[model samples]
Target: MSVMQGDGRLKSQRFRQAREGDWKRLERLMDKAEKGSARRLSDEEILAIPVLYRSTLSALSVARETSLDRALIGYLETLCARAYFFVYGSRSTLMGKLGAFFRRDWPMAVRALWRETFASGLLMLGGAIAAAVLVGQEPDWFYAFVPAEMASGRDPAASTETLRATLAGEDTSAGLSAFATFLFTHNARIAILAFALGFALCIPTGLLVLYNGATLGAFVTLFASRGLGVEVGGWLLIHGVTELFAVILAGAGGLRIGWAIAFPGDRDRLDAAADAGRTAATVIAGVVVMLFVAGLLEGFGRQLIESTPIRYAVAGTSALIWGLYFYGPRRRPAHV
Candidate 1:
């Protein structure tokens, strides 16, 4: 063996003979090497120590009798040194942990499904606005966006007493179930289309979300003009704030992916697009979850609560949850 290997082996043997309680020799030897030499320990050296030592000896084991109980000391030193070099020592450990969460964590699962939530919410809002505008300007425009059934229900000719009877009663479980099921399926379909169509997804999604926004804008505007705006605003604001924001966020996520493919800087279009898709998906998942929560509030909370303050409370709470999950401090797991 070369002189350096000979010296290491000889010193290792000497270390084994030292009092087990005296770590001075081991410390001196480590200190004598380059200041950061631990960072450069070979992968082979690290792997071999673990394999050779197994359980009976520390990773720093040497075949020699020690007067001192240095075996444990040596083993600990070696193990820690290797860890400090390869695992926790690397700053990317935190990032790796985050990636794992996104892949395996429960919160990440909810986030993953958010895109769908936003898509459906936006579509509903858009259609509502477009129909409202048409109804206001042409009185016939409402027919284009409002399904025939909904229009028939809202018809002025319908008995005022009958309309009150329908709107005033306790919301039926059947109605809530139907709405929830519809929202879930509809939202998922929109999210998939948003992700799949790339940039092309933007136009349809945007139109949908915008149509909703306009419908809402018009709804409140008309109600206010008719002196019922305060009541209408109170009711819609309870959930509208959270639901609308979620839809916009989802639309932005879709656009983000689409633009990446359309204008991939330097990287091949496919690669750039793929990279964009990954980030967009991460962001979109958060949006979908927000929408789902919003839908629950809109479908159930809005229908059940006639009080304005209660409605705002629900809206505010939903918004708060969204802010906390996506933008709040990420709980980083401890590294092994």
Candidate 2:
């Protein structure tokens, strides 16, 4: 038994000694990679990483099978795990990842959803037109579409002077910062809900988006009845261009998922939905950013800039920027 134990020890020591040099080299490479110094490595060293990693994996397998010293086995296990991640895991740094997302992933995802976006925009438009016609014929329909809390006395019952005063920035119950935060939260909630409810065959998402447009139409019709149409248009458009677009995109994201589930074609239902989800997720991320920008515009720009023409100009500028950003032609990335 003593002699057998001695032979095993000798075998373990020889095994480690044979591969120790390669293991140390791999460790050095891992250290540099972890420290973000991989660019400093020579081409030879960079190419050697996978070779050394595979060697280390082989060593670990041997150690486990041979029941080598616990400490030695543990060392090989740790080395192999680190080497696996260093060699095979994502190579992009944090900032690099963010740059890729903005430059490629987001815009690409939005472009892919053009069909869904058009459908969503049409739904919103249809709802708005329907509500406007209804309320134009019977002002009482305003109460049905616009919630009382949101109306805040801006309903048809309010006097023309009172309604116009609201658009003229007369209401100042909340600080600008607080108001911006509130708007951001509210808009984000609606956008996220629209995205989340998309899996329910898209019915909820469609209704939610339509309801939002109806509310907007109700407000517009109410103001139009009092001859404040242009004023309200400017007031809403200053931020609504971006805000409404974000909502539309959110609805589109949900609709994509719903459509996938409804017509999976040759793919499994879950698989199709998953594929759509990846693209939708990217759009949703960009939508959050759009909502944030809209919140700032609504909270600050809308309040500070009172000229109707200027508001329209700002809205047009925003629309132009968004159009060019999403629809402009660019060279596709190789990886994408």
Candidate 3:
């Protein structure tokens, strides 16, 4: 047994000695790559990486088979893993990544979620219709749908003049900047919740989305009943189009995750959910940007431009721009 052990040690030492130079070279290259110095590597060094990686991989396999020193095996394993990522992982800079996200990733993810987006919109519409009918029948339903804090005395109890004043930007007690900040924070919270709770089979996400629509409907019904339908329409649409669109997209993202978990088709449930998450994450990131723009419109444009016609024009232009950006046709990339 002692003689056999001695033979094994001798073989292991010879094996490591033969391949140690290649391993050290690969390690040096990996250090440069990891430190973001890959761009500075010589052309020959870049070409040598793969060759060294393959050699190290082969060494690892041999070490495992021959039962070489455990420490040597671990080192090779770590080196190979690092090399694999450097070779196959994303190499784009920060700006390049941002450009890719806006130009391709975000839009493509939104396109993929079309079915979910439609479903979410329909849910919101249904809730709105229901709330509108209830509020129209009895003003008390407005209290249930639109919280007091959100309504801020703009309910059925308020006079027509008061509501009209609010829409026409005549009510100036609340600073525009503060209002904008509040609106952004509120919308962002709802959007994030809708996405975060989607993993529970989409029930919570759907309900949250429905509730948001109900709030919108309740407010609209209150204003419309007071004979300020056209005025309120302009006021809301100025920022509502973008804000509501963002919420809908957020709901769609959550739905994607829920649907994947519930019905993974042939794939594993976890795997399907992961795939959906990647697409949903991309969409949610874009939704945040949309919400920011909506807040700006609500804060400045809605307050500065009190004319109903101009408000509608601004709303229409925003709608057109968003529609084109998300659903526009694109030329295919040329094959290399």
Candidate 4:
């Protein structure tokens, strides 16, 4: 045992002696950079930062594998961390970061979770289709699918004239602000809930999305029953495209985290969850903006535009713009 200990000590000492030059070089560079700024670094030193960081990381790994002395391991770990921050961490201004987030970080994050987003969207669609068909077959099913408070007195038994009046914004113009506020708060709440519940393995997220879709489906059936389906479709789509898409993105965020929690692959569960949270959080940020857009359309525009064609046109335009924003050609962050 004493011989083994001696050999270990000798090896660690030899290792340090061989690599001390690089370690001191890194230390000097870090000190110099911190004294002024990374921007002050010469081009050659700036280029060396990543190379040195990677080499230090490699050294750390080897030290751990070889079971080097804990003190040496600790020093290497600290050096590697500092190097990582200097090389990869952002030192940009807040505006610069925000610009990059919208330009690249968000879109890349969204693209990373396309599978989860697709699944979330399909769940909502299934619920919508199911509720639409069931409620159309039995009008009372509307009551079951849509809560009375949200119904706002428009039920299956209401006369066609009453329903048509609502769609034409005749009696509903005064309620536009309240309507927009309500939808904004409601969708925002659902999106947040979906993301928060993702730690529960996404079951709650899926169910919440499905319930939202079903409510819409039932609402559509009521309009169809009165032969006002086309009118109601226009009213809903004016903002529904953005609102619904926002909700789905929220669900995708939650699901991404939940999946990471449930199946962390080779990474640590906590680490995996953290990684997923970063990406998911980015999507959620964009979801808030989308909900704001939806709210504006629902509250203000919906009240002014009573023409079915105009309503459809507005909805189409919003959808097209959103499509281009999320799925458009890529661009490197200008200032990132």
Give the per-residue lDDT digits (tens) of candidate 2, residues 141-221.
999998887787988778888888787652463777888888899999999999999999999999999998998898899
lDDT of 3 at 224: 90
- Residue 316 lDDT, candidate 4, scale 0-100: 97
**lDDT values for all models:** 0.56, 0.92, 0.93, 0.89
Better of 1 and 3 by TM-score: 3
Best candidate, TM-score: 2
Sorted on lDDT, best first, the list reads: 3, 2, 4, 1
- Can you list the residue pairs that collide in candidate 4? none
Worst 10 residues of 3 by lDDT: 167-176
Candidate 2: stretches off by over 4 Å = 1-16, 32-47, 55-75, 170-174
Quote the lDDT for 67 in model 2.
90
lDDT of 1 by residue, 80-192 (tens): 47444443345445889777655445354335436644554556565666656565665444444445543436443445454444433256978886775675555556555
Clash number by candidate, in order = 13, 0, 0, 0
Off by over 4 Å in 3: 1-36, 42-45, 51-85, 170-174, 333-336
Rank by TM-score (best first) = 2, 3, 4, 1
Candidate 4 lDDT score relative to the true structure: 0.89
Task: State how far residue 326 of model 3 sits from its true place (Å).
Answer: 1.6
State how far residue 203 of model 2 sits from its true place (Å). 1.1
On residues 246-281, what C-alpha lDDT tens digit does candidate 3 reach at each position? Answer: 999999999999999999999999999999999999
